[model samples]
Target: MTLTPQDRTIVEATQAGLPLVTRPFAVVAESLGLSEAELIDRLKQLKAQGVIRRIGAAPNHYRLGMTANGMTVWDVDDAVVDSLGEKVGALPFVTHCYRRPRALPDWPYNLFAMVHGETREEVIAKRVEISSLLGKACRAGDILFSTRILKKTGMRLRGKEG
Candidate 1:
């Protein structure tokens, strides 16, 4: 999408992430020489125009004492996968969940949900809870624990080189 010069400036100013201060928008707006209200309005407009998907915090799960992270994969019956996925995603321990296309032959899991806890055993217990919820709809499943942390960040706008 084509962003206006001003919108581009706003995106560039905040893409690295908003300030960790109490008044983050205000800080960004000040840096852009715009009022906080104007910055917020423009952001809302950008979202409406599909230029921005969402603005949210990406917390560090490990820092929050949730060191054990497991991505549970399930071979769910396609007929009810979507409906069942919604239920699995809503679980308290599930940090994120979605459906993926099955690889077949080698990999047949079509549903994935991430669970986090203080330990691997805790994560496994949460996986059991998910399995119970899936019941007969889930045929096979497995859990992959995270070995290392990865940096996460939002989209960034590149500046024009004159």
Candidate 2:
């Protein structure tokens, strides 16, 4: 991606958080030898170009009292999976919901939902609730708890793709 003068400053400064002060942008601008407006403008440009997907925090759910986090997969009917996937994704307890192509030979689950709770029982209860919501459509399924989290972070600006 082309890095215009302003693009370079916003990319570098925001690679770090929006500085942690009252005049954060001013501080970032100073460091880059540019004005606050210029820095802000660059961020706007980057967003418009779709070079920056989002500016937000990536919190570790497990560390934040969400001890029981599981990747629950379902063997759903192909005809209804697309619709059910959207419905399940709308639930509050389900943080991440997506469709993965069914695996061959050893695997068949195609729908995946991430469920999190404070304890194992709570997680199981939520799963049952989710299962009930699916109303027997989730013929077979499994949950794989998160044992450890390797890393969590926002976008990477030093590289082209993150």
Candidate 3:
């Protein structure tokens, strides 16, 4: 979605984070020189137009003792990936799971799963459990452990509106 000048500014400001206060939106409004109601209305309009999906926290899982986050890639039967993907996605430890095209000549993994744990051992165990959950439909996969935290945020105003 194309952003209005106001929308662009608000989104950029909040991308860093919401203010820590009882009235975070009011702080945003003050910084933008807009009334709280006006700021909220613009946000509402953005949501209605599907420019913004959801406003939520990008929790620091590592700092919260979840130091190991494994990006588990899977090779699964296309027919059953969807139903099983939903089950995997619903897992609290599995922060994300989605199907992508089978990796090309250089890439082999297609189904992606994200599982967070307190240690590498725990993360691997989670993957083993996932494998059992998938049963025969799951062929093979690999686990990539996260070592550092990059920036995380909500929707971007620049591209890929969703």
User: What is the per-residue lDDT of model 3 for residues 67-121, given as tens digits with 9 covering 90 to 100?
Assistant: 8888999888889999989988887789889999985777677789999998899
* TM-scores of the candidates in the order shown: 0.86, 0.75, 0.83
Q: In model 1, what are the clashing residue pairs, if there are any?
A: none
Task: Using TM-score as the measure, name the better of candidate 1 and candidate 3.
Answer: 1
With a 3 Å backbone cut-off (N, CA, C), the pairs that clash in candidate 3 are: none
RMSD (Cα, Å) of model 2: 3.5
**Poorest 10 consecutive residues of model 2 by lDDT?**
153-162
lDDT of candidates 1 onward, in order: 0.92, 0.82, 0.84
Error of 3 at 3 (Å): 2.3
Candidate 2 C-alpha lDDT tens digits along 1-162: 777756765686687578568888798888888888887787787889888876766566767989888988888988889899998899999988999998776788999999999998888888887788777677788888888777555556574445
Q: Model 3 Cα displacement at 105 (Å)?
A: 3.8
Q: What is the lDDT of residue 116 in candidate 3?
A: 91
The segments of candidate 1 whose C-alpha lies over 4 angstroms from its true place after superposition are: 1-5, 48-53, 154-162
Model 2 off-target regions past 4 Å? 1-16, 32-34, 42-51, 154-162
So what's the TM-score on candidate 1?
0.86
Clashing pairs in 2: none
